[model samples]
Target: MTVPPPPWRRAPSPRKRAEKPLLSPELVVRTALDILAAEGIRAVSMRRVAQQLETGPASLYAYVSNKEELDELMLDAVLGEIPCPEPDPEHWDEQVKEQVRRQVRAMMTYPGIAKVAWNTPIPVTPNALRQGEAMLAFLRAGGLDRKQAAFAGDALSMYAKAFAYEASGWTFGEYDPAHMAERERRMADYVQSLPAGAFPNLARIGQFFNAGTSADRMEFALETFVAGLRAVVRA
Candidate 1:
């Protein structure tokens, strides 16, 4: 017995191909961070990261379970950049303020980075927990009660993140081009132009409102916070 061939059988056509690079957790994270830096959080997604890596989002799942996990890792990566200094009770207020300065400086290095961290439960990640421990240790050394030490630590860390988040708003290029100086000028002008009788208080001190550079403003705030903590803890 012999098989017969169909009269109109056609050969299959080739389909489009996609680049498939070897995937790894670090590579995936690094690519996602690159997107975060080049674009912004809004532009990041599993698919977007995969596309950058010449693969599919499904591949990313092997590393980060979801976007939430990715966000955590991203935050941890940033926190890892900060160094935890030794706790010194002798000058606890000064030591704590120095740590605040370092943390704030670190947060400011990456645009929109604080958004991933602010208000999130104290991170259980290694570097983040180390920060928490260091903050609490210094505060306790300053003679504060356990409750006070915890509150002080949270307050300082949150304030730094909040400050960085707000600053990032104006520095994100296309979103808002007005730097702090431009904003200062605008506010001063607006206040000066206001009808004098209605805003007498604002009119008098309007010129002094936004007088300093970013670093100067941060220093002023950090000093005030540290001073307040010193008074509160009676250290």
Candidate 2:
């Protein structure tokens, strides 16, 4: 029979492992956002987040339902950064423009997040709902009736999402001034080269193709949309 080691010669006991913090929805969202910021949205997934959290993927399900729900939560979190101002009756149009600008800016912070906003059919998340309500208030202050305000709000949301998505495509890394200039020059040349008889308007107006910056175009669009609303106001 083998003899046991003496007390002092005995091997040291295993130390108790440190406990991990409990999982929560907020933590999961934050982790996902972190992943999104580091590597574009495509890098974020339930399994990826769970790996980061040092837990099983099933553990994340208890907090976030699925990747789609996670995306919705992320979009809501981005929108929450935009401040909702009190509807100013006199400056309602300006307020609308400012809010839309803020929304675009917020979405631009994380690459590809704007596409989520664009694809989401009906976002019932808290921040998304708040943004919609605030937009309606602004539209109403501009003298739009209930139905008018509702339709305008929907249109404005679509515009903002589309704008953000497009801007992000250029903003993320593809924005090159010299390249854009060369491309525009080529486009203008191609348009002008077309037979005037076949494309009269395009050949004639092609000279104005590169006249304005994106910012200028956005401002003009906003002005046109807000000004057009006055015509639709209750008679």
Candidate 3:
């Protein structure tokens, strides 16, 4: 007989070959969101996510059709966490700002979720639609017409998403507090070293650069934007 396959070439153990449970789209999306939260968005992929679930890429197809769909799912999932407040005309400005703040906080916690949030189409998820309705309601209660309310909501949301995305991008890799401080010092020095006359504002404010806490920046931005909204409403 042809030299039989060596004993060392035996097939895998039968126990190890058992079929895995059917993978669902929800499972894939949840695992992907976890991966995105733990690692950066770059760490999320069909192959990697499938590996996390102990399955093959082919199996994931039974649920998520493609990367785009998975991204949409993750974004909607993130949006789901934001609680929609009842429209309170007396506190609509504060309410809307708080909602945006909460959303930004949630997105920042998940690292790359901000990027996904930016380009994801108008989400059709129940939570997302409900949020939109609530936002429009709040704006309208604050005296905006339907079209103005819709546009203002979209513009403010875009700003929040972009701000959070940039903030997340800055903290992507292994972050060390000491190292970050050193880097900030270097940046401040660089700015300060610029020709003082040519860059008076930057040189003068070098000490202020990267000096504020995330909360401080968020509050400042919120106040400024809301003040602008008040002006718009009054106009």
Best by lDDT: 2
Residues 30-93, model 2: lDDT tens digits: 8998888777777889999999999999989999999999999999888888899999999998
Question: Which candidate leads in TM-score?
Answer: 3
Score each candidate by Cα lDDT: 0.79, 0.84, 0.82
Clash pairs, model 3 backbone: none
Model 3 earns a TM-score of: 0.81
**Ranking 2 against 3 by lDDT, winner:** 2
Task: Enumerate residue pairs that collide in model 1.
Answer: none
Summed backbone clashes in each candidate are 0, 0, 0
Higher-scoring candidate on TM-score, 1 or 3 = 3
TM-score sort, best first: 3, 2, 1
Please list all clashing residue pairs in model 2, or write none if there are none: none
Cand. 1 Cα-lDDT: 0.79
Instruction: Candidate 1: list runs displaced more than 4 Å.
Output: 1-22, 178-190, 204-212
Candidate 3 displacement at residue 200 in angstroms: 2.3
- lDDT by residue (77-173, candidate 3, tens digit) is 8888888878999998998898888888889988988888777757787667877887888888888888888898898788789878878876656
- What range of 10 consecutive residues in model 1 has the weakest lDDT sum? 169-178
